[model samples]
Target: MHIVITGAAGFLGQRLVTRLLERGRLDDQTIRRLTLLDQIEAPVPDADGVEIVAQALDVTVPGALDEVLASGPDVIYHLAAVVSSAAEADLDLGMRVNFDATRALIEGCRQHELAATRLLMASSVAAYGGELPEVLDDMTALQPQNSYGAQKAMCELLINDYSRRGLVDGRVLRLPTIVIRPGRPNAAASSFASSILREPLNGEDAVCPVPTDLEMFVMSPGKVVEALIHGAEVPGERWAPFRAFMLPGITVSVAEMLETLREVAGDAAVARVRHEPDARVTAIVSSWPARFDTAKARRLGFEGDGNFREIIEAFVDERP
Candidate 1:
């Protein structure tokens, strides 16, 4: 299979590329070729037997998608997007990068391979909005409260339509706040969950923007990769040709997250955390739903780690 990963230099993107190699998909016997694209120059992690050529190109530029799709990869993992905070702060840039850029990818794929290709979109819980209802089922309607959420919801719709028209096979996974994320804190409001743990582990201070009681959903990069690969391999007939649905994950409160970190990393790591809430951040977080029925995804056999403790352990194993 020819596989291409956009945003190939980002934290999760790099990890996914590594994971794919570990899965032995990069071996020349299994993969025909591997292409990596990113906004800035990036080093391709050493993958034995895999032919990987990378380029630094801003995807927003015209004709960029066509260049990336020239080889017509069997599967395209579209993970490039502006963070939630950035989208909220800069509406125009958000629409340009997060929305328009993605549309370009879809259109490019449509123009190149038609019905022969598949796309896996990395969406977020942010796609949900405005004080999550008591319960969010697959049938729930989307009412995004932030520019980022609104952008993702609209993209899901376009992806579904593109699939229906046989432009490409598209599957959407509403990712949980991938816990144990390794990197500096990003603009994502949910970054605190990983930041509090990551910073403290390095003997550095971290901030908690939301109260301990605040609850939200989360998962690890391991599970996120699993969900994406599983979605990619699903037979086109397994479900109808076009349906963008939620991917299942676990939910926890800030207190729950910290407790799990303390248990996994001990009091020394926990001591480095500081709480300083910003009302705007709090209000945005408050509108997020902490849990979802996820019956559809669960029934489909997609899920995350059993507990946050496991998530914390994974973080330690990777970062420490």
Candidate 2:
């Protein structure tokens, strides 16, 4: 089987690549070729019996995906997108990359004329917004307040319709904010979530952009990679009725995350986080529903971190 991962240089894509290499198979088929595509070439592991191809290409440029899809991937993990704040800051860039590029990839799959190909897209909880149920469920309607979420929601519909037309076997995982990402902060409004813990643990002062009381729906990177693999392996019929659903996650307040940090790394680490609110970020982050009735995800075999403590500890242990 050949697998193609777009945005393969990003945090999640890189982890997913490592996990796939470790397993050596997806949906019971041996992965013989792994194609990684992004704006810059991604790093690949040296593994026996697997051919690795990493390239730097813009998906939005005409014929960009055509060149990649010619490799004929059996499965595609679409993880590329302009993040929340960046998307909001530049409408044209967001629409070009998030909307146009995504559409091109899906259409490129259709043009492949393959019998079937699995498409696993990384959607976001940002897809839900405005007045929402205290705990969002599978049945909640999408009313995205941000450009990033709106683009993802739109792509979900496209994937569903394309799947219905027998163009591709697609599934959308509406992910919670992935916490404790290791690295310097990026433009994502949710970057603060990881910054609060990651920076402080490294002995650097970090800024808390939102109120301490603000709540967030979060998942650890380890669990999300597991969810991605599981989502790819599930049979098509099991997800036929609906191609999109939320992944399970824990609801943690800003205060709760800091408390967990204190427990894991002591008061000095917790003390490094400073409360300096940013209204723009707070608006975008707060509009998302923090609590979710993810019985559907749980029933479907997706899992999340048991608590914030595990999330922090996992970060400490696994990060390079």
lDDT of 2 by residue, 70-92 (tens): 77788899999988778888999
**RMSD of every prediction:** 2.1, 1.3
Clashing pairs in 2: none
What's the residue-level lDDT of 124 in candidate 1? Answer: 82
Once superposed on the true structure, which residue ranges of model 1 sit more than 4 Å away at CA? Answer: 26-29, 239-242
Question: lDDT by residue for model 1 over 1-320, one digit each (tens)?
Answer: 88888888887778778777788653233765668889986677777778887888888888887866877788888888888888988999999988999999998987786576878888888888764568788877888888998999999999988888878888788887778788788777677788888898777899998889988778888888888777777755544543666776688888888887788778877778888988877887778877788876776668778987888777677764
RMSD of candidate 1 to true structure, Å: 2.1
Error of 2 at 58 (Å): 1.0
Candidate 1 lDDT score relative to the true structure: 0.80
- What does the lDDT read for residue 173 in candidate 1? 85
